[model samples]
Target: MAEKFDVIVVGAGMAGNAAAYTLAKAGVNVLQIERGEYAGSKNVQGGILYAQAVEALIPEFRESAPLERHIIEQRIWVLNDKSYIGTHFRSDNFNEERPNRYTLVRAQFDKWLNGEVKKAGATVITETTVLELLKDETGKVNGVRCDRENGEVRADCVILCDGVNALVGSRSGVRKEINSKEVALAVKEMHFLPRDVINERFNIQESEGVVIEILGTVTEGMLGTGFIYTNGESLSVGIGVIVSDLMKNRINPSTLLEKMKSHPSVAPLLKGSEVKEYSAHLLPEGGYDSVPELSGNGWMVCGDSAHLLNAIHREGSNMALTSGRLAAETYLELRDKGQPINAENLKKYNQKLENSFVLKDLKKYRRMPHIMLENKQFVTMYPDLLAGAAETLLRVDGVDKKTKEKKITKDFRSARGIFGLVGDAFKLVRAWR
Candidate 1:
């Protein structure tokens, strides 16, 4: 005899935990299977957790979760090889009682959430991998088959929340296989520093942190960005280049990260830090376009498996949580209404996603990836030009101000021929719209 469940959720990350928690609390028997030693053992994140999305699922998380800090400022830096032109936005309003976001270490945060799922009555089994979806003759998925012998376990529905890799989906022949262009390889390192050192370097007090997002030369002209995020006593610094770009440039993403840490503007902040942990993972960069059929038969997909990341905002955890919650909600609704899980009914998942920012924002930026790829100037010439223009104006040269203005204009025009410059500007403006 094989064990069975009302709902079986695979992967146990944010999405899996969210779905399991919701279903179990709603009185549905749910089983969660995780291949990691523990829930977050395989998890990796830059650690910005959006408060509103998470609080909706676990309202008291802040009271107990191991949070690093609350972000009160964000810096966007457009960099040249040796300089940066940037903008910083900081607000005291964010310091109020219910902060909008928090930085969390995935290893601790996911473990805590998994505990909550168990407390909500979900059966969680770790070190277990679901190899395939068991389907009946009618092509309806009835359960998942684990790696163990005779591991078939029946369930009304299965949620696939496996992070980023398309192992199950590719094997299932659901969507066209993911290609290099649809993904990005990101490498990150954790730097250990004392809490006071971190605060002083970023110019913040306890519990307040800053995030720096860098673009341009950081990716070696690849279509991606580099970032530095402050945690309580460590910093998360990383760089991601489109997998296609990585292959074409023949550059390892890890090498790009080392270059970023050594950047003149970036090095000073980490003058005395020690590297603590180094990890690399694939990020689904295909945006709205790469998402496959999210639901089929009795099986549904959420989180990275379905490519539910908002790469533009460096938002993955939030989407994972929201998608997981929506999946569980959809499941409960159908079960209460006595409907069998099938493609027709599961369409609700797609509809709900379309209504939310998950799909909408991706749609808005649908053209950005292609645009950036085609016009490499956005990553190379533009950043250098911005820095050069600023330097010319700010430097106290003996030359007249008019000469400086003319020199800046000439540099810009020569760097990006006048017509090309105008065309690039127009394309960028239109893409954002």
Candidate 2:
């Protein structure tokens, strides 16, 4: 006889661990399976972790989770070849009793989360590949078939917490395979620096960190961005581009990263650092328009599998955790009401997402991805224009302020034309709305 579980959560990623921990703590017999050797083994790159979503699941996460440093500064930069126009927000308020964000190494963080899941009584099986979803004669998913011998396991329902690829979901016909245009390929490297050097270079205390989000030519005019995050003793730097653009241009992601690291505005930051780790992963950048069906009979999808990533805000893990928690809560409510895990009952999960900020934020920026992808000027022409204008205005070379202002206007108009500039602005406004 096959072992039965109240819920079987596939992929022990952020979403999987969150859902499995939530369900197990609620007295549900949950089986969590991971294809990697351990949770987070496939994801070693450093990234930001939003406190609100994490605290919602594990209220005392900060006490034990493998957090690197609390973010006290955030910088957004638009780069030209040799110069960058940037804005930074830094506040001592971020060093308060509970910080809003932190830099974390995903491998250690996920391992910590897996420990929490086990503590919550979820049975976790590592190195297990779930081949496909098992459906009954009525076309309702009821279990999963794994790669191992007699690897069929029954469950009241299954949760697809798979990453951006959503292999199982796609194979089971739950969601369509992601298009290259709707995803981004991000390559990251962790450069090791002494703790004191990191602190001195970033002008931060031991517990504080800085994050830099770069735009413009760094992506080679692609619709993507580059980033640098400060960890305890390392800097996480990376560049990403839309997969479609990469394929269309035959641009190698590694070459682009190398160029980004060599840029004048970025090179000094890592002058003497040693590269300790390198990894790459796909990110869902489709915004709201590309999200597929989230729930069906006896199954639901969360995180990247559901295309819940909000690329505009660089918010993925938080959205994943929120969606996972909401899915678990929805299932628990249904079970309490004596309802079966069907398409009708799982609609509550989608409803919960709609009521939360997850869907609301995604809806707000629904047009951003398309606009950014279509308008190459934001990453190409505008950066040069802004840099030139700033230099012309600042370098007091005996030129009158009025003439310099006129020269800036003429240069912009000459490059983009008036109609192009107006159209780009209009599109940007529409997308931000």
Candidate 3:
């Protein structure tokens, strides 16, 4: 006979912690297993935390969670080698009593979240890898087999939150192996700076932060984006590229990140910062089409494992947290109704997601990924054209405003024919809509 629990959650990232905490808080016997020394040891993120998602799980999280800074400003930059055309949104509204978003260090935040899971009465085992899913002859998963000796544990249901490269799900034939074309490889560095220096450079006060989202030639025509996030005392800077594009273009992600750091527009912000940490992770960018089977007999997949990322908005954590909570809620619903944790009953989990913003937003921009990947001009030609037009209009080089406007129009026509421009606009609108 093996030890038994009501539910077993694999991995301790956003999804896993959320699932385990939700289940345990509901008084369900949940066991969360992590392969790392502790929760968040293997997790990496761009360091943005969506407040509403976590608030739904733990309303008072702001009082205890290890938060870095609340974002008060956002900048989106279309970059060239020398210049950028960008938009900035800053408001006093973000400084309200309850901020909408914050920057956090994943390792600290995950550890804090896992602590909540434990305090809620869930069993957690760290540094132990679940080797495979345990299934009965009926082809229904019921538990997991871990690397430790005699490490078999039974559970009525299993929630896979193992991440983009989850092995247990793929190995157990629960989901298809990830496709390179549908994933992205992101490399990031943690640059430490004094808190006051950070605030001064970004023109903010303590507890206020800034986020810069970058697009354009920094990726060298690859399908991806770069970002810089301000923390309380550090900056998170990174670049991500489609794995297939990296393979096809033979681009090195680390080298690409280095080039982005050296960009004239980006370099000044990072001046005098000391590099303290570097990490890389894969993210699912497949949108609605790439989502795998959500649930089956005795098992459910959530978060990155289910391909629940919304790349267009750079939102992963919120989806992960929300999906995890929904999965747990689904199990609780079935249990209360005296329904079996079989494929038929678990279908409700998928329905729940479909009704949430997690799936709705992804479906809305489902075609954007394919369109962006197919059109290189979005990351290359268009960025350059925008930068050039900005320069043309602002240089004050003795040319009349009307003449400068005409030159800008001519430049666009010369770079991309009128038909090409119209076609690109159509594709963008079609995908975005």
Candidate 4:
């Protein structure tokens, strides 16, 4: 005889832990399984946590969570070979009692979140792989088959929170295999530095942090971005590129990261730091069109497994946390009303998402990924042009101001003609709209 629970949450990542924690807190017999040695052993992120999402799940998270630093500054940089045009927003208002965002180590944060789940009465098993979903005679998913001997456990519903690869959902024919063109391959590193050194370099207090988001030639003409995040005593530096573009150009991701690190605008931040960790992970970059079926039979998918990534704004974990909470709330609502967890009833979950920011924001940016894919100028030619314009305007080399302005105009026309510039502008507006 196999054990049974009300729900089985797969993959103890952001989505899995959120669902399990929510369901277990509501007195549902939930069992969460993780294949890693611990909750966050395999998790990788750029390390920015949007507080509202987690605050909704665990109100007192700040009291015990392993948070690294509260972000008080944000920097955006567009780079050429030797120079970058950038903007910075730093506010003391962000240093409130309850900060809006924080930088964290994923492994530490996930482990802490899982601890909270266990405290809420969920049964968590690590080092266990859920091979596939077990379905009943009528094709309803009823449980999961794991690697352990005779390891079959029944459940009323199964929630797949698997990461971007989504092997479980793909293998069980629940969702299509991830498209390479719709995904990104990101490589990250943790560079350890002294806490005082970090604070001094970033020009911040002990509890404050800074985040830098980079675009332009750092990706080597690929559609991607680079980032640097501040932690307590280390820096999270990484670069990501679309997998399809990487394959098309045969560019090594590590090589690209190394080149970005050596850039004049980026190299100074880590002058004396020693790299302590290196990691790589896949991110869902397909935006709205790549999303698969949300629910069917007795199964529901959320987080990266459902392709719920907002690549335009670089947000994934917050969506994962919110989607997980909503999925659990949907189940609880149905259970309270004595409704069955079937394909028809689970449509409510999709409806809830549509009404929430998750789908609304994704829909708003639906055309962005396609636009970016079609316009290489946004990442390449524009940065060079902007840098050139800035230099030409600023360098007082005995040229008249009017003549310099004409030279700038000539450069723009030479690089991307008037019609090309107009078309690019139109495309950008359409995508944003």
Clashes of each: 0, 0, 0, 0
Which candidate's lDDT is highest? 3
Would you estimate the TM-scores of all the predictions? Answer: 0.98, 0.99, 0.99, 0.99
The weakest ten consecutive residues by lDDT in model 4 span: 1-10
User: Which 10-residue span in candidate 3 carries the lowest summed lDDT?
Assistant: 1-10
C-alpha local distance difference test of each model:
0.88, 0.92, 0.95, 0.93
Name the runs in model 4 displaced over 4 angstroms: none
Query: What's model 2's overall lDDT?
Result: 0.92
* lDDT, model 4: 0.93
lDDT of 1: 0.88
Flag clash pairs in model 2.
none
Query: Taking the tens digit of each residue's C-alpha lDDT, what string does model 1 give over 38-57?
Result: 99999888868999888989
Candidate 3: deviation at residue 278, Å?
Answer: 0.6
For model 2, how does the per-residue alpha-carbon lDDT over 1-433 read when each residue is reduced to its tens digit?
2799999999888899899999999999999999999999986444999999999998988899999999999999999889999999999999989899999999999999999999999999999999899999999999999989999999989999988999999999887888999999999999999999999989998789999999998788888889999999999999889999999989989898899899988898999999988899999999899888889999999998889988877899999999999999999999999998999999999999999988899999999998898889899999999999999999989999999999999999999999999998999999998
> What is the C-alpha lDDT profile of model 4 across 112-197, one tens digit per residue?
99999999999999999998999999999999999999889999999999889998898898988999889999999999999999
Model 3's alpha-carbon lDDT is: 0.95
Weakest 10 consecutive residues, lDDT, candidate 1? 168-177
